[model samples]
Target: MRIQFMLNGSSETVDAEADTRLINVLRERYHLIGTHASCYSGECGSCIVLINGEIFHSCMTPLFRVRGMRVTTIEGFAKQHAYKEVLAGFREAGLSPCRFCAAGRILTTHALLEISPNPGEEEIAEYYRAVKCRCTDFRTYLKAVQYTGRLRRNRHRVS
Candidate 1:
């Protein structure tokens, strides 16, 4: 099956099987390896990607489901200015997740900040619960998200 969709803000088409997972299409066809697959069953948020501006586990999403939809992987999200702010926040907070969970954590951070530019601590903790990063403590990651939110809010205030 030929699937067409807007990938990373660009129109993209690839031949894929109906049963093929979107993760495979991304990593194999497009070489978007930033969308990792840890628990292929979606139990882990490692394969999460933005589908039409929301997070979805690409490992569980079928290629056909993304037809004509907009998909954004960490590679794509990293190109945005918000990514720079998030990176700065991480650095300021001295928080760095392991390579395994970095992409998904960053994507989740982007989603959370996009939805609520000034999310409360509880909101940050609530969102971080889904992203399991064993290497780093939840407090560190939560702090990073909160810091990023603050940076974004400050940027908006200045604008």
Candidate 2:
């Protein structure tokens, strides 16, 4: 079947099977490798992608589900202003996630901040739970979120 959707900021159409996972189409068909396929069961969160402003585990999500919807992988999210600011904040806060979990965490953070720009520590913790990062402590990631919030506020204040 042919599915059409908005990818990043452009429209995309591809032929895929009924049971094909979104991650497969993304990585294999479109070559959008930023959305990794870790646990096919969706427990790893490594395959997380934003679909219509919400995070979905692409590994478990069917391609037909995203048909006509907007899907944003880490590659697409990287071009966003929020991504840029959050990344800078991560660096400034000395928060470094391993490559395996970084993209998923970033996407989760972006979704959280987009929904709640001034989220409290509890909220940050709650959202961070979506991404499993066994190698790093959550403190640095939380600090980065706080810093990004501040940066966003400052930018809005000047504009």
State which candidate has the highest lDDT: 2
User: Which parts of model 1 are misplaced by more than 4 Å?
Assistant: none
TM-score per candidate, in order? 0.94, 0.95
What's the lDDT for all of these models? 0.86, 0.88
Clashing pairs in 2: none
Question: Per-residue lDDT of 34-135 in model 1, one digit per residue for the tens?
Answer: 888788987778898999988888999999999999999999988999889989888887888778888878888888889988888788887787677686
| lDDT (tens digit, per residue) of candidate 2 on 39-148 | 89988888899999898999999999988999999999998888998888888889888888888888888888889989998999987888886865788888999888
Model 2's alpha-carbon lDDT is 0.88
TM-score (C-alpha, index-matched) for candidate 1: 0.94
Off by over 4 Å in 2: none
Could you tell me the TM-score of candidate 2?
0.95
Q: Show the colliding residue pairs in model 1.
A: none
Residue 111's lDDT within candidate 2 is 85
